[model samples]
Target: MRIVIVGTGNVATVLGRLIIAKGHDLVHIVGRTPEHTVPLAKEFNCSWSGFSELHVINADLIIIAISDNALLDSASTFHTNPVPVVHTAGSVSMDVLKNVSSHYGVFYPLQSLRREMMQIPEIPFLIDGNTPEMIALLENFSSTLSPFTEHAGDDQRLRLHAAAVIVSNFTNHLYALGE
Candidate 1:
């Protein structure tokens, strides 16, 4: 499967690595600066491009691994036909890709991912989309990557995200206070 990732950040770099390791093709790794993403693209052996280059590549799935704030804006830069696009965000809704395309979905991995730390790679995947086919495809894609995959709707996902913040973020804050 051809995959295009729209961010060279931790999430994108890690996920793209796994996808490539799984024998899938990573078509491109898009980022704002060539300096930021070019090295990662070389390391992953994928093409590097900026935001405007999104339309130039064709992939079965386009994963937006950019920050939550940049999602909507980054999404607006691409206008692909029927390409299944998914974002890796907990708080953001699937609606962020509202005007981007019909084949958009949410592929949130329910875990705190960081470059310095090695993740378990078996975290629960919160999957949702606009269509049944897209949802199924996401489920299959996720299951291949991890054992835990579930169909979490918008409301459930949002609530889970909030809880994650309290447990992960807020708890971390308390730990910091203790120190």
Candidate 2:
């Protein structure tokens, strides 16, 4: 599958490398700064471009692995051509992609992502898609890396992410305080 990855942050880098290593073609790597994506593009052997250049590429899937706040804004810049687009966001609902494109969904990895390490963690993917076909495709795609694939609606995914924040984020804060 030809994959287009938006954002060259930790999650984007990790996911791009993993998908490339899995023998999938990463067609385009989009980022705000050239410096952020150039190295990743070189590593993945993909074209490096900005968010505006999203429409220029031909890909089977466009995965937006950007920041939580930037997801919607970045998605708005994309010119949708009925291509399957998925955002890697745990807290945000799939509805955010509704206006962006008809073939939109969430491809969230339920784990803390860091790029330095090559080993992608065994994290379940809470997936949601616009159609049955996309849902199945996302489910099968998630299954490639992790065994657990759950079908979650927008509200359900949001609530689950909230709980994760309390358990993972806040708990880590407390642990740091204790230390």
Candidate 3:
């Protein structure tokens, strides 16, 4: 599958690495900053460009792996048709991408993502899509990396993310204080 990864942060970088390792071609890497995007594109031997240059990209899927704050804006920038847009944000809903593209979905990895983490954990995916066909497609793609692929609605995903922050983030902080 030909994919275009949007964003330069840790989540995007890590996911891009996983996609490339899966033997899929990462045709284009889009980001506002060259420093962040170029190295990742170079790592996969692909071209990197800004979000505005996305129309030229020929991809089956476009993964918007950016921060929660920039997720909606970033997703809105992509043109609809040809490639489906999937955002890797647990807190954000599938509806965020639906407004901009007919083919939209959510691919939230149910795990704390760190770029420094050497091994890819058995990360489960909480996926949701605009249509039944889109949902099935996301499920198949997610199943390649995880044994489990769950169907989560917008509210369900947001609540789950809140609980995760409490469990993962707060607990980690308390552990650090104890240390």
Candidate 3: tens digits of C-alpha lDDT, residues 90-129: 9888888766668899999878888886687778789999
C-alpha TM-scores of all predictions: 0.92, 0.92, 0.94
Cα lDDT listed for each candidate:
0.83, 0.83, 0.84
lDDT of 1 by residue, 91-117 (tens): 888987867778888998787776554
lDDT, candidate 1, at 111: 78
- Model 2 steric clash pairs: none
* Stretches > 4 Å off in candidate 3: none
- Clashing pairs for predicted structure model 1, backbone only: none
Q: How well does model 2 score by local distance difference test?
A: 0.83
Number of the candidate with higher TM-score, 1 or 2: 2
Q: Please report the TM-score between candidate 3 and the true structure.
A: 0.94
